[model samples]
Target: MEKYLMKSKAMHYVFVIIGTILMAVSINLVYEPLGMVTGGITGLAIVIKELTGFIIKGGIPLWVTNIILNIPLIICAVYILGKKLLLHTLFATLCLSAALALVPSVNILPEDYLLAAVFGGALGGVGLGMIFVASASTGGTDLLAMLIHRFKPYYSIPRILIVIDGFVVAVGAMVFGISKTLYAIIAVYITTKVSDGILEGLKFAKMAYVISDSYDEIAKAIMEKLERGVTGVYAKGMYSDKDKKMLFCVVSKKEIVDLTELVSEIDPKAFIIVSDVREVMGEGFIEYKQ
Candidate 1:
């Protein structure tokens, strides 16, 4: 058990390292170069980096700004949230700052903000997703949200994040102009969708509900032909004044067509409703591992 725990921690740190690198790559190569601020501490860093160009030759380096800004936040996080809870987050934040310093700033997409937005968003999303899976964060706006939520329990963390990040984006618009900021918004949206997709799990499936008088026959056909399980839900129809069993089944995306055809064949008048299932676990799906 000790060995397993050690291995898990090791893997988690590895995830944090890799995730920070990817995030740094997106920032330096895409967002920073294009003046597209997607929001967060890094986004604020980019804005500052641009604004300070008048004072400094190339403006303050992103890593410098990132680390300097985070120092106080880290100190507060330790005091407020405690050291134990912040160990992983501190590691992640330092990793991100180090990555920003080490990774070269090369604009791969040059003036093409569209490609920059999409690609940068996807890369950052996947990276952030991996970090989240490891139960860690890069400790920028996320940490700020936690800290705010700590004091004002009424305001949720997510709402705080939106307000904070939105403020950063708005500042970016003023600095970088509307056209680039619009692209930034697109990147933000894509990043959100992709990260959400990663957190929710990639194994997509379909859930189906069938309402028909011949539900028993349909259920039997599904089990035998599709090799899937089915459950009968007790449902009553107010219009028809009838009590019947509604067939509930979950099947892979590929099998949904087969299930639909089988149900239609069994009962042409069957009412079928199909919806997307983001992830499925248990028998014939994602298994639990220690």
Candidate 2:
């Protein structure tokens, strides 16, 4: 057990290191040079950096301000997201801060606003996605989202993040002008798109929850034809006040259409909910070998 715990901690550290590098590359190579303000503390940093040149005489610098902004959020995460999450987030945030401070300045993109916005957003989005997959974050609005999620699990965290970012972009517009605002919007869009793509790319399985009168037939078919396993969960219908069997299964996307069709043919009244699962570890799923 101690060995496993140490291994897990080591993996988290590895993720933090990798996530930090990607984030630094995105910020230094793309966002900062273009002045594209993204969401989160990084975005706020860009806004501040623009207003005041990156010149610090004494005390904490603008870069430090970005790190400090996450302090309150980190405390909240510690209470809400648990100790492991708190440590991972703190490590990831510190790595990001250090990377931004240490990476030698470089200008990769031309002064063209369009290129800057597009590439910067894409890079930042990929970095964010990687950070999420690592189960760590660079803090900022993500901490707020986690806190909000603790209170309202049903609320859409990404949507809330968008709203927060939108406000930041609005402020950037006021200070930087409308043109930069437009570029920032473009950058935000790209970041979202790329982040989603990266997350989806990391998905390993699909979870299917099936509600059907022909539960037996579906289960048999899944076992015999798909060579997949199924677990029957006893469910009580709210409106019908009748007990029913619901089938839960995880399968590859290759079998999704076939599964749907088999269910539809077996019971036209069947209800099926399919969702992408990022990672699954257990019987019939990806399992780590000892």
Candidate 3:
């Protein structure tokens, strides 16, 4: 058990590092050059960078703004909540700051807003996905969300984050203009979709509910041929007023065709409902892990 925990911790940090690099690259190389602000502390930093460019040469660096902004937030959070709760967040945030500082800025993509938004969002999404999978966050507005939720327990963290990030985006619109802001919104949308895909797409499966008089035979064939398990659910047919066994099974997308065919072959009148499953765990799927 101890060894497993140690390995898990190591893997978590590894994921954080890789995710930080992707996120920083997206910000510095793609979003910064195009003046796209998607939201979060980095977005605010971009706005500040542009504003300060009037006075300071090249304005403030992203890492500088990130560190300065996060420090006070981190200190307040620690003071109000506790250190233990923010340890992982601190680590991830520091890694991101380091990455932003070290990763050289370059125009890797064309100056096209659409292209920048798509690729930037893709990189940020994958980075966020991995960071979330590691059970950590890059702090910034995430920490702000936590603090707000702590004070106002009635409001959820995610809702608070939306409000806060939206405010940031609105402010960014003021700085970057409506056209760039529109592209930023598109980038944000793509980021959300890709991140959600990373989190749930890989584990997606198909679920089927089979109802027929020959449920037993269908279950047997599914288990024997498909090498999958089926559950007999006690169901009552409302129209017929008969107690029947409904077969419940889950299989990969590739195997759903075979499962339906096998059911149709055995019982022509079988009422089968197939649905998409976002995630499945257990035998023949992802193993349960601590």
lDDT of 3: 0.84
lDDT of 1 by residue, 48-102 (tens): 9999999999999998888778777878888888886588888888899999999
After the best TM-score superposition of candidate 1, give how far the Cα of residue 287 lies from its true spot, in angstroms: 1.8
Ranking by TM-score: 1, 3, 2
Runs of candidate 3 with Cα error greater than 4 angstroms are 1-6, 79-81, 145-163
Q: Could you report the Cα RMSD, in angstroms, for every candidate shown?
A: 3.4, 5.6, 3.2
- What do the candidate models score in CA lDDT, each in turn? 0.85, 0.75, 0.84
Instruction: Write down the TM-score of every candidate.
Output: 0.90, 0.68, 0.89
Worst ten-residue run, lDDT, model 2? 1-10
Please tell me which model should have the higher lDDT, number 2 or number 3.
3
Off by over 4 Å in 2: 1-7, 54-62, 71-89, 111-119, 130-135, 189-201, 204-222, 230-250, 258-282, 287-290
Give per-residue lDDT, candidate 1, residue 186: 83
lDDT of 3 by residue, 1-290 (tens): 11222256788889889989999999999988888888889999999999999899999999889888888788878887787757878898999999999998887876689999999989998897777667566888877877887889787444565568788889999988989888888888777777666654466899999999998889999999999999999999999999999999999999999999999999989999999998776889876676
- Point to the candidate with the largest TM-score: 1
lDDT of 1 at 6: 29
